[model samples]
Target chain A: MTSSNNTDTRLMTGNEACAEAALVAGMRFFAGYPITPSSEIAEVLARKLPSSGGVFIQMEDEIGSIAAIIGASLAGVKAMTATSGPGFSLMQENIGYAAMTEVPVVIVNVQRGGPSTGLPTLPSQSDVMQARWGTHGDHPVIAVVPSTVYETFVWTIKAFNFSEQYRVPVIVLLDEIIAHINEKITIPAHDELAIIDRTLSSQPPESYLPYKNTPSGVPLFAGFGTGYRYHVTGLCHDETGFPSSNARIVEELYLRLNRKIDQHRNDIIEYQTLDLDDAEICIVAYGSSARSAQRAVRIARQDGIKVGLFKPFVLWPFPGEELAELTRKAKTIIVPEMNLGQIAHEVSCATRKDVVSVNRVDGTLITPQEIVKRIYDVQV
Target chain B: MSFRYEIRLSGSGGQGLILAGKILAEAAAIYDNKNATQSQSYGPEARGGSSRSEVIISDEEIDYPKAVNIDFLLCFTQEACDKYCVDIKEKGILLVDSDYVTKVPEGKFTVHKVPITTIAEKQAGKSLVANIVALGIITGLTGIVSKKAVESAVLSRVPKGTEDLNTKAFNLGIDLARELK
Candidate 1:
């Protein structure tokens, strides 16, 4: 994949790649605030979207940014918004609103350090827990973390696809490192891309239900002003999309929302394992931390240590089963992240093993040497 | 084992070090068919603050993007030179702009001092092309990327109207390095 066309191999930043891939994935509307590390995505879209017959709007704030994208998605356009930690925090309510309303919107959080604007220009994977739980309620979450600029491009497309197919909000979690780093990526040809657009209702406007449950547990979408008159609310709603307080109907709605993603885990979940076959030590990581872990694994292997890496691109689905299975032969597991043991807890729970948590909350990325030191510490 | 070459372009903002890093990385990755990763870190200040762009070129996939063992280091300011010179590997090349980066620190790496900004001003007609000149010198001195690849990458990245100026600056840099050798 190259700069403009599919055949040309060009140098691009992770933000640029994400923006370009969103266009390829049929994103026609972008609404975002200019945040450091993530602003480039919005800037690129602003320059290219209008030329490509798409819409780009710089909202007043992050809250307005996400709300605008949600509104665009409801209007039958594939929409996305990019922001950093502070902005991601502001969009939490709207993210929940989209999830409850079953609106297929892509929200990208290019994570920075902090509980509250800790570091604006630096990278940190501290938002792992926030991405899964920040939106409030027990709604199922589909979040992807891309470790490379190429993966950022690839998974941004997948995020849109997952959102459209399941009628839910999908989050692409990128830290400052992956978002700003420049890499050589080839943009695949349009035909080579697999874009899953929202499934529209074939039923007449009177017969159509915006949130009707089917065998897949995914409801058909009917865009507003598309002759489909249906209620949409964030409250617990039944298949008819209207607010319903009845216990059974509300419970069923929540169950289906969870089941649609959980039952189809095999299809929605994506992960990668490296040199785990005969290894005695395993490193679990994702996003930019995965890059450091990968290098640590290589260095450890060269030092005659049996070490491997388990990287999850699909973070929300967690891929616990796969990690547990892959690390069955390993004697110890190591979970390294930018946060202080956010995903490490998940690894311990999944594998029923005590994991060596190598964490850094500082603005800088965790170095490979730092991870290698942890691997050696746990190796004994 | 595959070979990995790391390069760090360090200077204040407006030096175009980041763009030079990108062009060098693109030359290796796109044209040379090698794998490359370029990452940058800068201060909040728009200009005069410390800015550093690092590129890693490897025959294999780049597991980590940041440069740990720098093979080539280009410094446009004394602060960047002093801060980053320690990270260069033994016997690595350290290129500095003699105009701004005075008092070069003694290190294990080989030092090549040149009046980069002055040359860019005199030959390229502006100091803005110093990054391009530095790219040429880096390419010529290390031969990490082919001259043809660097030229193509530079032409593709520079603004349309300034291609001739950038080319002149790049060639001057290459010739300067050749004379140094």
Candidate 2:
């Protein structure tokens, strides 16, 4: 189905749409080891990237995959990688390196059931905490969760935008169900959506401080070959980009790294709520679980249950502020996830309310009827 | 009131049921301008394990992408039919391959038995097009998706050189379903 504006509309899985969106977002380099539920992204990019004058590399492992993207991002190319749980674990060290060095790159993790190589072909949201704190240190992260195939396309582009805008690695966390489910989506025209590019330093080569803390807390980037020489390291560094062990400088470096995202949480956070105006019961969910919650909300509403759904698009900045505010009217708050209350704990901590956690990690999706039953159980 | 029709195509992994499910969803969502979601679940084995592809088509947005209360089911094997017949809605349509599904499970739904793979091999001259033939039977039985839309979706999805074979297989299955109807 084509729209009047001539935008292409066709059926695609979330993974396919994500890869296509990455190309639209101008991702010039993709380095990833093929992993189930996320392999389609690498496969698509391998065939399409070369034709688009981009590079696609199948790395030896996830560590090399993430390292390649970081290196490519340092060279001023839009770069990304995709993996599932096991691969994501191996990439954590570099994820930290990317965070400390302030590299603009996107990582798509299509989470499957896992502690380690757990269920290769099943779905899970167990990686919620991992996506947030997978890498060591007090680093700030922007991770977005897309519940639908359409949102997968939109949020992938947004992940690229947020990564470039804040000069940090952004994670796009999708579960296996969303990655595999096919739906119809209209591809927006290139000029329709806002695409953010990395900010380059216009300062003279001698005066360029790679980590210069600007008013926005984001330092301008100078690509490796851009006639600007600056030290890039994981060591605690100052505005001059040189290693510093100074007490004040170390503290300042950490604060600015966080301040950039913390100060701009309003711009980075995104969420959607439905039938919440008179909702006494609010269901907080994300990724594929949110889709089930949405159906439960509709079913409960039909029964006059006064239920609603709160779905977070940008999962990392966690939408806690909005949840705390919007859920004030909700007498009972429920968090249904594929894991064992990973995000439910966050919801409880965020709202400081007694939240009911409905979890399923047996590889099958939590059904809408199950959520509705949970709502009823709370009602009584 | 929202109108939702759920369909399930279940069989062993190598039966191409997943592709059939995709074509059905594509027909409903793309050619017919309806909202549709198609999802599949299979075991670790690449073939022979139980595999299921579900399609939920609605006039309104489909909040849940799975088929819980299936309106129609196409089972290519007895194992698939036995496992899935319990989930079919009352008065639902259940079509099975007579050659593979010898013993049909008792259900509240109407059961139509056809030699799906045999027809594909004998009529379409290939067993690989059995999935396409099943799609034809699905379209013809329930009228869940329009015939024209299914035709368009099938043509677009099949290999370029073998369009005629697929078309012949699909139409033969459609004609068979019409006779059963």
Candidate 3:
């Protein structure tokens, strides 16, 4: 039965959109622990997943949450888990496991204030470094940070696609502001969305090697119960998935995992450039901070300042090349984040230009007026 | 003319101001064909805390989501009214619930003493739907969203089996707003 609530255009929170997008992207397994800001994702999935014949398990902790999704992914089902800062910290070990095992899973981190439960209800973009490096060891990650509720939905789908395509754990980073904010969104018809599923090994169970590397540096996954009795381990493993301490084998496995993402960097990086064609000053921001930057750019333009905006959705595998290319003509790049200059450092390193950082860690959003003030201050 | 209208709804947490804000935004964006965003603020406590929700309706895409200089403000409590009244733009609109907010602060903005709670409790039998009632009155007074669009949005968001009560509350609110006008 169709209802008005079921209409294409409805108001949705960013976390709700993330959950719905995951369902659309063929996610059948969700294991998450409730945490503020990110809890809505788990709450919505808990109620909705079962209706679609998917499983939603509220694990004991974030560690178990990520572990369960990894296990489910190994079994060939698209899986995900959502958490906030403290819980995200708890999931790091398992996140590392998922990365090392090349298990395809989407991890949503709705960022709240923290070193350790700094602010439960407030927003922060401090998890930028954590999402990329919190997981121990050298492992490749594709992290996407969305600025809008609509982009949250789109990027969640992209997160699933990238995870499956590259056989890597993908992180969708969201800040508290975006997570709680509700906005009108138009959900596209199912047929309109592009979905990517994991590639399965064509070789028979006897011949199949789960970790077998290919030219693309991605191995075809043969999930359990598929007659492909392949072993899965977090240790440095060879093509057969057996633990390997051999220096050469370890080197090859590490290089392959990194190369799988590095080689395909162009395809994985996604960003948007606003009015940069003739801009002299560019504002570099992402997630919720980008919203303020966009407004600042407009206000600056009105006052006849050649200000532009470069917003990156894909934070990791940091769209450095595209950002450098886009802001080539700009003399200064203003990096405003909820944190104190995490992404700003990357912007400086990538562009090799003067980067001005406007940071706020007070658990309040960086206002457009503040960005506009920076634009004027830097212009002179 | 390109314009952006910011509406702020404030009250205690359980008063459902957030839901009202969502309904108003949905009506503007979905039914009225505009760009809108709804954001809310509340204390850590779930209830009895000062809560506020803001919706920004724009002809173009909304860059900043939060309300800065509120074009319209609806306060269901005296505390919320006093706290947020200063943020309203000069000669803007400030709507206070007459039942709860008796002492209105003098401001340059237009003040409308809406008996939102009294109307909801008396006319609709359930003061729980006061938020919806406020939404209907706001729509009626501001004409920001069409009557039909607000009705559709209210029906879509209100809980099942209580649609009739909420609809009655909304209509009564519209009638009260008409009388004030």
lDDT of 2 at A328: 87
List of clashing residue pairs for candidate 1: A1-A186, A1-A187, A2-A8, A2-A186, A2-A187
Candidate 1 displacement at residue A144 in angstroms = 0.6
Worst 10 residues of 2 chain B by lDDT: B151-160
Indicate the worst ten consecutive residues by lDDT in candidate 3 chain A.
A1-10
**Every candidate's lDDT:** 0.90, 0.92, 0.91
TM-score of chain B of each: 0.98, 0.97, 0.97
Model 3 CA deviation exceeding 4 Å by range: A1-7
Task: Determine the iRMS, in angstroms, of model 1.
Answer: 2.7
For all predictions in the order shown, the interface RMSD in Å is 2.7, 2.6, 3.1
Best by lDDT: 2
Residue-level lDDT tens digits of model 1 in A69-147:
8899999999999999999999999999998988999999999888787778889898889999998898878999999
lDDT per residue as tens, model 3, A1-380: 11235658777889989999999999999999998978989899899999999999999998989989999999999999999999999989988898888999999999988889888888899999999999889999999999999999999999999999999999999998899898878888889899999888889998888889899999998888877787789999999999999999999999999999999999988889899999999999899999999999988899999999989989999988898888888999999999989999999999999999999998888999999999999999
lDDT of 1 by residue, B1-181 (tens): 5899999999898899989988888888987889998898887677888899999999998988999899999999999999999999999999999999889999888999999999999988999899999999999999999999899889888888998999999999999999988
Candidate 2 is graded, for docking, as medium
Which CAPRI level is candidate 1? medium
